[model samples]
Target: MKIEEVRQHVTTPLTAPAFAPVVPRFTDREYLNIVYRTDADALRAVVPEPLQVEEPLVRFEVMKMGDVSGYGPYTESGQAIEVSFDGERGEYLHAMYLDNFPATASGREVSAYPKTAGSPKLYVDNGVLVGTLDYGTLRVATATMGYKHHALDVREAERQITVPTFMLKTIPGYDGAPRVQELVRTEITDVVVKEAYTAPARLQLFQHVLAPLADLPVLEVVSASHIRTDLTLAPVKPVFDYLKGVRS
Candidate 1:
């Protein structure tokens, strides 16, 4: 390809590109979010600076994307904590695991999302909605919730979905040292909530060396929600530069 043609490419040249050059958007996403209380100290230790903990609560989410703009479909599971940045309450995404390689690679390289490859499944069995994440043959986390127990308020759900999301984006240097480290923020726009519901739920996180979901122990089950929404994943912005404070 000519140099002028290379400039039009979306992803890095000569690298293995999984998804398309553009960012993928999801539609009619089935979501199961389980909110729970956890130890305040453990949360304080992991949560980065500039983002304060709103409460000792965390939300574990298992999402099944029905259709995507670029990539086809995938299932993802992760944890986010209730946090505030500059007095604005939002979620700080801790970690995420998905089965799609292209989605994982693009998410990490483009948006700085902490995406790793794993087996994550969300499905309805009998009358209950079940979500599970596994590393190889070992199950790491599992969650279940009642299927559409009560209708969710559309306005409130839309407001909650638009909240700012923070993530720790890190890329190692050539020598395996810290290279790029930033506190990235993302917000979803053009949200259209088709259906939502509140329900009873249960969660179980097993101890594992690689997947440590149990690090933030589930102290108490708070609430659960199942939602179907269509939204676009907006571009990420860095709110805090972690490397700026390093002494040269």
Candidate 2:
């Protein structure tokens, strides 16, 4: 291939790419979000600087992707910590685990998402909404909630999911030195909330050497929401470049 062709198709494998060049759009994406209070010190230790943690809150989410543009149906589970940047309220993505290889590759390579490969399932068992995450056949996290017990305001659900999300992107050079390090932010826009509800919920996180979600022990279950929507994720933009600042 010519140099120009190589430059244009340098995504993953030089011969074949896993996913197409298309913006991800989800249809009937369901979310089970449980916002709980955790230890403030734990939040401080994980959350990066320039981001302040006002409340010791973490949102544990299990997402069921019904239909996506490029990738097919998959389930994802992760945690986001409540944080603020430059006086703007947002959530910092701590970790994400899913089962899809293409989605995981694109998330980490293209968007710099903190994604890892794991087994996560979100389904309705009997009349209860159940979400579980396991690593290598070992259960790490489990959450249960009443299935649509009370109706929730659609606007509130939209607001909750549309909050600005921040993530740290880091890449090392061939010599094992820091090459790219920055803080990026993104939001989910173009959403149509199909259903939203509230329910009594409980979370249980087990101690895992790999998936250390239990590091932030659940102090109190502040709120839980069951929402279904069709949305598209916006492209991420870098807000702070740590390496660039250090070079100057």
Return the TM-score for each candidate structure. 0.93, 0.97
Give Cα-based local distance difference scores for all models: 0.87, 0.93
Clashes found in each candidate (C-alpha, N, C closer than 3 A):
0, 0
- Model 2 alpha-carbon miss at residue 184, Å: 0.4
Q: What is the lDDT of residue 1 in candidate 2?
A: 86
Off by over 4 Å in 2: 246-248
Predicted model with the maximum lDDT = 2
- In the range 16-49, model 2's lDDT, one tens digit per residue, is 8976778999999999999999999999999998
After aligning candidate 1 to the native by TM-score, how far in Å is the CA of 212 from where it should be?
Answer: 0.3
Residue pairs clashing, model 1: none
Worst 10 residues of 1 by lDDT: 9-18
lDDT of 1 by residue, 1-248 (tens): 78887776657644554568875678988888899999999999989887898699999999899998777788999999999987778999988999888788789888978889789899899899999999889999999999988998989778766789999889899999889888889998889999989888999999989888899999999988888999998999888888895312
